[model samples]
Target: MSENEHMLAVRSRINDLAAKAKTPEGLTEAEKAERADLRQEFLANFREGMRSQIEMLQVIDKDGKEVTPEKVKQIQRDKGLRDD
Candidate 1:
């Protein structure tokens, strides 16, 4: 599935779990398991998306210099996303 579709599915499951949490009955064991799995998948997707976006970033200074943070620069360098 596409990223948008995957994200929608994850969000839907999360919302479902949230609603279950508000009820006096609460989530069943199966629902709790599903929630944990969905949460992990969602976090993995979020981290990957953030990493991709950050990889393409180039921070500029007021003086028109490349002032990207050292941490990000190190990631880029390690990933071979940038030579500098």
Candidate 2:
């Protein structure tokens, strides 16, 4: 499946596991392990998306000075998304 489909599946599984955990029966060790792995996968995807947005960012003040943060600027520069 595609990335979106995969993410949706992961999210659905995470929710299901969470609901199970709240019940009196709770989760088995394997289910708990699966939930942890799925959570990590979800977070990794989220961080990459945030990083992509940050890399594409451009900030300009009223004086027309580019005010993007140095760390983000360096990321953009390294990715060849910006010059200087």
Candidate 3:
């Protein structure tokens, strides 16, 4: 599946597990483990998406100076989003 589709599936499963945990029967140990793993995967994906956004960022001052951080600029350069 595409990234968006996969993320939606993961989110659906996580919500399902959460609902199961709230019920009287509650979740089995395996379900709990699966929920934990899914949460981690979700978090990892979120962080990577945020990182990509940051890497593509460019900060410009009102005076027209490029004020982006050196590290971020380097990342953007490496990704071919910047000339230097």
Candidate 4:
């Protein structure tokens, strides 16, 4: 499938799973398993999206110093921002 179609399918599945989770009956063992699977899928997609965003940002900031996670956290700490 194309990227748009794939993203739409993922979003639709996420919405369906969220609706199931919100019901008062709650999730059964099987539904809980399905929810875990959906959560994993969503996390994987989110991580991939973040990586793409980082790549795009790197391209945009080509003239700037490359910032690693460790460095960013250190900078946040130095600025008195919450690291946790």
Index of the highest-TM-score prediction: 3
For each candidate in the order shown, give its overall lDDT on alpha carbons. Answer: 0.91, 0.95, 0.94, 0.68
Instruction: Candidate 2: list runs displaced more than 4 Å.
Output: none
**What is the clash count for each candidate, in the order shown?**
0, 0, 0, 0
TM-score against native, each model: 0.81, 0.88, 0.90, 0.52
Which prediction has more favorable TM-score, 3 or 4? 3
Better of 1 and 3 by lDDT: 3
Q: Across residues 1-84, which tens digit of lDDT does each residue of candidate 1 receive?
A: 998998898999899899988999999999999999999999999999998998779999899999999988998899898877
Candidate 3 lDDT, 1-84, residue by residue in tens: 999999999999999999989999999999999999999999999999999888888899999998999999888788888887
Candidate 3 has an lDDT of: 0.94
Model 2: lDDT equals: 0.95
Candidate 4, residue 39: CA error in Å?
A: 1.4
| TM match of model 2 to true structure | 0.88
- In model 3, where do residues sit more than 4 Å from their true spots? none
Cα deviation of 39, candidate 2, in Å: 0.4
How well is each residue in 52-79 modelled by candidate 4, as lDDT tens digits? 5653342224668655476555555666
Rank the models by TM-score, top first: 3, 2, 1, 4
| Model 1 / residue 70 / CA error / Å | 4.8
Q: Judged by lDDT relative to the true structure, which candidate is superior, 1 or 2?
A: 2
